[model samples]
Target: MDGNQRETIHKIEKLLVERGLRARTIGSTDFPNVSPMKAVEQLMRQCSGAVILGFPQTVIHQGISKPNTQQEKNITDKQLPTPWNQIEASMAFMIGIPLLIIRQQGIEGGIFDIGTTGHYIHTFNLDNYDWIREPSFLQPFNEWYREVLVNNN
Candidate 1:
């Protein structure tokens, strides 16, 4: 996670820790002594599941959707998370492990889109912590954590 997301990452880490699970990131928990992809693959092999936090890493103030296409439309304030989240999450999916996707409000498309992975996408506002305490988030999260625990054994 970047500096912009440290606090949110911490809160997520705390939640996982409370449930006897530790959240590990590529740069934070494992340094790349080898190629980055190799390191990430190795980590994926060891994981019971993955929680992909889709925090905005890029924003389009004004742009066009499907530029040059007949379906093109004007877009504004479109936020996108680090592409690494999708990459890592896809790796986890390929490994046949459970996945929990939490996306910031307004961050959509790809795996963040509902029904993309069979797992429910929980959306939250970055400006507040309300989602953490809400049942919608907790139910799916706890359910996914249960799968992780089962996989661990």
Candidate 2:
């Protein structure tokens, strides 16, 4: 996590710990001495659930949608997370692990898009931490945690 999202990440980690779960990340919880793919494979294999945080790592200004196409349209101020988020989320999905997608507000596309995986995408503002305590986050999280509990059995 970068300085921008470090506090948010820590808060989420704390919440997980309070719920008796550990939050693990690639660079933080697991080292990446090996190939990134191999390292992620190893780390995910040991987990029962995955929380894919879609924090904006890239932004596009004054871009085009469907470039060079008949239905092309203008796009602006689009925010996207690292491609790793999609990759890891796909891994967790294929592994049949419970997955929770929490994205910073305004980040969209791929897994962050509604109906992408049919999993609820919980959103929170970068400047506000209140979303963590809201039912919107808690409900899906609780349900996903239930699946995690069931899978462990």
Candidate 2 stretches greater than 4 Å from native? 1-4
- Give lDDT tens digits, candidate 2, residues 32-132: 78999988887888899999999988888989989899999998898889999999999999888888999998998888999988899898997776778
Q: Find the number of clashing residue pairs for candidate 2.
A: 0
Runs in model 1 lying further than 4 Å from the true structure: 1-4
Q: Write the per-residue lDDT of candidate 1 for residues 102-149, one digit (tens) a residue.
A: 888899988899998998988888677666878888888889999998
Kindly give the stretch of ten consecutive residues in candidate 2 with the minimal lDDT sum: 1-10
Quote the lDDT for 150 in model 1: 90
Query: Cα deviation of 91 in candidate 2 (Å)?
Result: 0.4
Instruction: Report lDDT (CA) for all predictions.
Output: 0.86, 0.88
TM-score of 2: 0.93
Which candidate has the top score in lDDT?
A: 2
